[model samples]
Target: MGEKSEIRMTNDKKRIVIIGGGFAGVQCAGTLSRGLARDQAEVVLFNDENHLVFSPLLAEVVGSSLSPLDVVVPLRQLLPDVLCRTETVRTIDLAASEIEYESDDGEIQRLGYHHLVIACGSVTNLNVVPGMADHAFPLKTVGDAVALRSHIMAQMERAEVCPHPERRRWLLTFIVVGGGFSGAEAAGEINDLVRSSARYFKNFHREDVRVTLIHSREQILPEISPDLRDFAGKKMEKAGVSLVLNARVASATPEGVGLQGGQFIHGGTIVCTVGSAPSPVVGRLAAPTEKGRLLTEPDMRLRDSKNVWAIGDCALIVNAHDGQPSPTTGQFAERQGTQCAQNIIRVLQGQATRPFSFSKLGELCSIGGHSAVADLFGFHLSGFFAWFVWRGVYLFKLPSWAHRFQVGFDWAWLLLFPRDLAHVRARPTDRVSHAHYQPGDFIIRQNDPPLNFYVIEQGEVEVVRSSPRDQNGEVIAVLGPGSFFGEKALLSNEPRVASVRARTPVEVLVMGKNVFTQISSTLTPLRDALAQALNRRRVDVWKDEPQAYELLKRTPLKELMEPVPQPLLKPTAALAEVGHAFVEHGNEFFYVSSDGQTLDGVVTITDLLRARAAGAAAQTPTNQFMTANPVALAADDDCAVASNVIRECRLKALPVVERKDTRKLVGCIRVRRLLAYVFKHAVIGAPDSCQARNQLAGGAGRGMDWNNPAS
Candidate 1:
């Protein structure tokens, strides 16, 4: 935005710029035009498409029961007194109170505002599930409805020609990845559309079509009560819609949807209404936000900036009545928008503005086959009656009379005729398939038949191979994004040599061995990249092998005999005897034991001082002053485990005993000697950090952190 010269207010009229034409922006603009005079303020509303989409009935458009034009209201006509601009936002400068936009004529223009209202609700977030942004159908706008409706028709047509039952089943399957209002209603409407239209095609049997709703939660329609959700679920099931509860999408592929528990839902079409992420502009702004929504004061003004106000889904406004963040819904947003206009006028007139406060009046959702669920006036209603109420409420809420008449006409016409079966061109899926794996999941197993070569798109993987000494898996190396693996097996025509496990939740592009081989045979760059990666991995595997002396690394402490004094004695010994015995035996500590082998406790200097300060009798036994069950290392455990215990406890030495037979005392290993052994053996083939010669060879020694687990 340009500074002073471009922002000079014409006629000294303050400009109120609204950035969205959605429910909140439209209502706010309408109320502003009526409350503030033309000379008092210039109201400008901006939308990329210059239309207010009636989002509630968007599913009807996809079902072909309503026309696309009926669901959107042109901003210019809806808010006649306000100036409407069809422009896409490029940048918003909150500090300067200016906005940069690309006009329809492809010109860069700047505008300054006195009060800025951000009502740009949200866009469909398909990024949560891998490949969904490219593969899954979204229903955020009228265009989405058109594309989806067309895709549904195309699938129907394609199924009619398909001879294979499995291919036809794939074509006929439609899965919605959410069980909320949008997803449930979309699935329900789709079921009606396909089944109702199936009778028209001789080859399109009603049984050929299938619609499934997948939700992560135990029940659907979280906004509604459990009873209502059950009511809705039962209705949907009876209407021939399948509900897959407690299943969340792990990823999406052209073939189907994969769930978190390794369950795959085969389908040709996948629709996602599950997640919504914040806009990039919201991230660019410097302000407080809750879950990506801008935090707003009770009066609807942005918390940090005085001149800025926000409403709708993008703004997390607190409801003064319940003191909770308001739910993102059409009715609530409209109320917020109306309250914002009043607040703006009050602020302009130098009066105290009121906080936004509204209790939800009602809720309504259509669940297909002329059935619906509604909670109005604190009373729940369902079946045909709720369906009728759903239609009436949305019809009355339509912004313009033109939309009202057109939508009412479509519904009236839909009752008498089957939805139009016009074939729509379906979008082509991406050639590369993507999937996500959770941490510890084996992306490829050792000795498993090679199926795919994976290119890491996100997160890291640990290349794990069996150690020669123990045959237990040891992590060899960590590979990150842009690294490709599985080429060795493809090149050698063998099963996988090493397993790849996710070090974190990972996203990867999977190419079949055939396609990978073909690419490697032709593309020099890809071939060179694979060759370099394979060579590094091959060397990594060789280095990963444990040396023969690595046996010492794994050998239990019980097997390493240390000729120390036999310190175990009766716990009932006198305090004088304990002190004299410790001096005579040349030991810093003494173990209290009832039997010759079982260690009951330890009497260190710290324990003795505390006991003496507490004024224990001079005749007290050593057991009375001892610290019991101090963290001890198991005798049968490896040296690595013993070293870790010694390091963590910050102890010079620790008692070791048989884990299976705790009565048997093996020996105690000193920290200094443990370090000497580790340095002598661990550094031979391990990473360079283990070069511990200086520390162990009589130099001043410090405690080893051993914090790096992989090392």
Candidate 2:
């Protein structure tokens, strides 16, 4: 154990690296600094952020019960003796006992560590429900809490100005999508703030504001006893918070959250207090992981590596006391961090290490109104007593006296006065989210109520509609950048009639209906533009795609095959006439037919490029360069075969014939429109493999250059 001790002591000091600045990381580093001799060892803490976030109070910040400054302390000020770095860790080489990180200036720096402590906390994940990440507010950090509060206050201001009662109601609606500690507390706080602030606005009534607490389980706060959980739930419900129990969030949109049942909870603001995903740093490690969280031994060391240890939300630590995986809550993480630090010290000093053990500190959640439910010290407490204990416990746990005092002052001010009603400006990127989708992915589906109005920032999407009798849909129009859709349903208060599928890899901005209506109500030109677009809605195809929504099979070509306008040219026609055909009809390929019923050859713009390259004038005959017996799509063939034909033949448009015998052209399908047709018919419920096939077909069809064959 002492072999590398001398070498590890850089400049006669052993180096220990601790990552993250959360409860686990900060406490571990602080404990290590005190335990290790200053001259014999060095404790280095690396965090992308400069301050350690007092996470328990983050929800309070949103409710305006706590000040922003009260929930975070500077890492440098808290641990003056420890070396602190505000840099992002890039990679870790466990075998070499080294970590590589990038400085703020983008320069890379490497440091060797004799022992490493990984306590990087979790990040908010909304992947459980579609569009949840883009639509829901998170309470994981101070920034998140601040942004949420700003949004809440802004909604109130908007409601005061809005004349429409429906719009005002949407603005005032707040939905918290978790029933556990964060969810219950956040929902309760939001309820109190919105309800109390109504008197300040003449247009706003107390009944206009709505707050709902949704949980998938039968009860909220499983950590506490049923009596406490029931008491807390009843208290919040009595405070005008709607309880949605035993309902999982199937999806989330800007306008609302969709329950697994046929229920849509409309809300302007959605706060998701669930789904804490493992940190990206933890994912990059070479060790084994259980669902992105690094798995650690009973002693807190990694499953395979001895030098590296992991704790906090990013690690799946099993408590030695219970012989069960440790809870990801802050208290458990903090205890794990302290024990891990002591073990590291013992191992380095050539002493036996002990497995991590800890007793439950019990659980508590403040459910607004200066009331809380707690199971502290095996004593079941409710109402003011529980609330008092809750505040005292968190206040005592603050990183520094300065934070505790600031928080205490804020708490005292909150009890005496109403919540501060000022809107704190936050960066747009903090609350607004953007997403990218590959071609063939469904951006929106039909029959779903429109919660968000979308604007295409890049790439294109096809508006698809299907007939009531037909399973597959038809592409009505191709929308490009600056194009917007899904507004018609939101405005009309109706479900979406057609699906919006990505025609290419697309990036789009989405806003809740409250925001959309707020902006549209003020801007006449934008409202008029949206109105004009909605007026052009073709309702026939909006009936929803039955064949493509969820199936894993490839949508057959026969299903989408339709006769496209095939502009024809005689064998004697020249590239000059073909150019005229291009102007008259946008289709690049023209059938060189002696008889209009049968196709003799195919002529494309590429034929002109080859003809010109060979010194033939623009007046060159269509037969000279037109591809003979071009591979065509059989009307009965599947899309996968058609994909192969277009790919192998380097053809942009394929001829769909009545049969192989007569060679009679039914219609021509261009690669561009053909992919759109396939995506419309097949993408709704198609498997990933089917989507991949159609996407590949779409790619093959897009790169064809009729104007310049070489391109």
Candidate 3:
């Protein structure tokens, strides 16, 4: 309340706060400044950067056709009447009509406002496809453009120095994911730049360079008309850009991108122009959201909030003309900004605010080699004429006369001279990242150099080793969630001994060898956990007990498991009936089923005791006390696998099913029976082993027939 009072003051002036400095925020401030006098309101715009980026022309920056500074206008220069503050906003307190931000002086401050405009745009997120965040380049900001430009040039340099032909081709290849305006333009520009600059490098040839664009739709530029899309696609292909339509990226890695149907496109560089997520500030808002954008009223006001408005990429505003949500584009953002400002002024003057309504002006996309496509009003344009029109339209769209002139000059210079090839040589920093693999995808192959240590986050993977008996390779172990691998080779500084392949779609958090070593050496808890897992998973742990290992490996689970107890209880049976059955059969657990054969659930003695102690009625159904879909073994599984599963799960007994896909109950194997059978059959040379078998066998030695192990 005190903060509100201070912000309002005693004067008649009102304070309007704008949270972004993009096109929407700039347009809103411009409109508000003209509509209201100095005494009526004070307009303040907050942006982390002091400049507004002309995003549509960002591809030109990557192509080296436009100077980086030419596409950006200083906010202070653009909005002379509005107060522009370059500070990071920490949070927006909607209820208090205040915003908390960190000032340039490193102190937290809160400012109250009569009206707040949310224009903070969306951010690039590549996590939709696994390993994309780690391996793909994103083109969203000016910095991203610069970084990508540098990387492109760096790849060219590497390709020149490489002696191997295939390696050189890999270095020269570039893959762009997405078919939207950004993707099309970026791919075009990149192809043009690399092909044109090939002559500058001694060993570089235009034929060796490959630029591929992958899209999940049938055509490129789905926003434009079908004819225009076809024209653009054909024109780009003629200009040497390969189009991969109706293909979706399943995963991305340093090697390349893997498509959904197991096709891998090999390339050294991957540029992702898809996947946008809400900005942190916008995500923290309490308002309703669609997809990731805040849902606003037709007049651009935030739903349920009187003085708060939202526009641009962060907002989902329905258009009055089409009765459809407005597309997230610069033109729509500008229109929303202007309409929102007028509405705010109307609210201040006690007048009715009008709904936002506007028809789209046009769309222009520039492909490489002086070609473009345009959809203006109802007319379609393409080729060199469209390219010229595209340049002319964006030239005047520049906020400042100086920027327009600078960009115009750059375009003219590009037509007469070659594209720039020089780039910064700063080394990229390395960090831990995440990756995804599809079923049968080899995460690591045997004898391959260890580069990354992996921790399974989702799905399962199998440790496989090549054996003389099986040419396809024998599966040693199946690891699920919370299990980790690839550390043994990394820690020992040796090549991998066994290959790991995804048993299902898998996600893993990957750490580089250097990072894994540093953390494993310093973190005590992680070190101890890794050591314990290593001891349990060691491949040759039974080397000393050869005979015992041979017996466990050669025997099948069906031979070692006893028959399932007779008269399985129905799920409708009473808890009292289950207790009585357990006592009568002298079994520790009973299987529950609806039919006579199919297993539904298992009820242990512990479960019965728990249900009784919880004051459950004796008439309570057995299903209520049963553990459904319990861990089970397949009838064809070897005794060794069952032994490992039992030891890992710390279970006294495990149920055997007909197969993994079918739930038909076959039999059960007890730990005591398994250990006793192994000891009695295998010859024990060690004296301690004989004593251990005598203690384990106990009363079983009197009545049990050693010849029938499953009895």
Candidate whose TM-score is highest: 3
What are the RMSD figures for all models against the true structure? 14.8, 14.6, 8.0
Query: Compared with the true structure, what per-residue lDDT tens digits does model 3 show for residues 61-177?
Result: 888888789888999899999999998677899998899887666667788888999999999999998879977999999999888999999899989988778869999999999
lDDT of 2 by residue, 1-711 (tens): 111121234645778899897889888998899999888788999998999887778889888888788888999999988999888887888888888886555566678888899999888887877768867898888888989999999999989988778868998999999998889889888998889889999999889889999998998888789999999989988889999999999877656788897688888898999887778777777889887888888899998887899998889888889898888899988898899999999988899889888888899899987889989889999999889999999988887888888888889888888899999665453223476554555677667667788888876566565555544675444555677888878888888877788765567887777888888899999988776554333221212333432221255556666674666678888778877887788866677777777767787777777787889878887888886655455465455445434543445667777753345777765556555664555554443544444433433223211111110
Q: Per-residue lDDT tens digits of candidate 1, residues 1-711?
A: 232324566646889999888999999999999999888999999888878999989999888888888898888988999999887676788877888777556666778888999888877788877768757889998888998998999888878887668878999999998999999899999999999999987776898889999998999898887888999999999989999999889887666788999988888899888789776667677889999999998999999788899899999999999999999999899999999999998988889999999989888999899889999989999999999899988898998787788888888888887788877564443245777765665788677677788988876566666545535575544455666678878788888777788765677898877778788899999987676544333321112323412454566677554543466757888777776776788777877778777767778767666777898876798878886544455566566445434433445677766662243566777756755565555544543434333222212233222112223
Report residue 493 deviation for candidate 3 (angstroms): 6.5
| TM-score for each model | 0.62, 0.66, 0.69
What overall lDDT goes with each candidate model? 0.77, 0.76, 0.83
Runs with alpha carbons beyond 4 Å of true place in candidate 1:
1-7, 104-107, 426-711
Better of 1 and 2 by TM-score: 2
Error (Å) of candidate 1 at residue 324 is 1.3
